[model samples]
Target: MSIALAAISILHLLDLVILITSTAANAWIVDGDLSADLWYKCTSKNGGYHCKQSINEDWLQAVQALMVLAVLFCLLSFVFFLCQLFTLVKGGRFYFTAVFQILASLFVMSGAIIFTVMNYAAASSSYGYAYVLAWLAFPLTLGSGLIYIILRKTE
Candidate 1:
């Protein structure tokens, strides 16, 4: 593959890795002895730790759904990129892949924003690595999408 395509592939892969890791981790917020994620809230109790299902808030559910959608869209975009790379004409652009990736970026951004806004009113806790990673993935996904849109198929 050409260097440009390889570079774009690597970037897309990196964004996907970040998205998956952030979504699955249990560290969106960390308090003194408690941590919360999309799925669960864990607390240190009696020298041990206990986990419970996250509160059933509509916004929280939306954030969870959006994050999952972002991961799926990113994965679909990668698959589309591979297929287009093999079959697309030399001058054709990866519009399909670009659209999917752009949507992925938007979904991730929306999820993160909602989480940040909703959590601001909750008990005091600092954002954790997973939260930071979700924000980090947004720009990477956006850049990858723009690259796809600008890139042309090459020999």
Candidate 2:
């Protein structure tokens, strides 16, 4: 049980880190010298990089909001998990933590799907590591959430 608890904690932390990195990274899509992220679009030219704010598109804005919300929920879930670990009764389950984590996964999945669908026409460019990270976070969060649901406060 101790080993399982530690593993879950590690997974939750990893998910949070990946969420933060994916949200902050400026490489959701890359094409030659150009790269774009939720916040900005950057281009490399003449041995320098020029960055500009991302376009004011409704979908992009939605993605940004969802990603931020996901990170926040993940953080909240982790905190709640720690609190419940100590305060919860021996037989009680981590329902609150599980719900928050599941919500976070949903948010991540929604944001990534929106980005993929909106950018489908831009086949010339390739999806970057940040984009992949966003996708990767979805399943990990969901799995952790399910695990939390099954976990009980055991002595």
Candidate 3:
């Protein structure tokens, strides 16, 4: 039980880290010296990088909001999990944590999907590691949620 608890905690922490990285990284799309993210568009020039605020597109804004929400929900879920771990009755499942985590996963999926569909028409660049990390976080968060649902508090 202790091992499972520790593993679940680790998974949740990992998901949170991935979510933060994907949201903040300036490499959602990359082509040669050009890279773009939710917040900025950057290009390598001479020996330095030039960056500017991202264009205000509805879809891009939606993606940005969704990603931020995903991070918030994941953080909230972790807090709830810790609180529940100590106060929840034996055999009580981590339903609140699971629900928040599942919502976080959905937000990540929505953001990634929106970015993929909308960005397809905007640029011919390849998706970068940050984009891949967003997709990766979706499944990990979902799996973590499912695990939480199945996990019961035990002495």
lDDT to native, each model: 0.94, 0.96, 0.95
Could you arrange the candidates by TM-score from highest to lowest?
2, 3, 1
Write candidate 1's Cα lDDT for 62-142 as tens digits.
999999999999999999999998899989999999999999999999999999988863457789999999999999999
**Which residue ranges in model 3 land beyond 4 Å of their true spot?**
121-124
Better of 1 and 3 by lDDT: 3
What's the alpha carbon RMSD for model 1? 1.4
Q: In lDDT terms, which candidate is top?
A: 2
Clashing pairs in 3: none
Give one digit per residue, the lDDT tens place, for model 2 in 45-136.
99999999989999999999999999999999999999999999999999999999999999999999999988754668999999999999
Give the per-residue lDDT of model 3 (tens digit) for 29-113: 9988989999999999999999999999999999999999999999999999999999999899999999999999999999999
In terms of TM-score, how similar is model 1 to the real structure? Answer: 0.95
State how far residue 116 of model 3 sits from its true place (Å).
Answer: 0.5
Cα shift from native, residue 67, model 2 (Å)? 0.3
Lowest summed lDDT across 10 adjacent residues in model 3 is found at 117-126
- Candidate 2 global TM-score: 0.97
In Å, residue 14's CA in model 3 sits off its true spot by 0.6
Q: Rank order by lDDT, top first?
A: 2, 3, 1
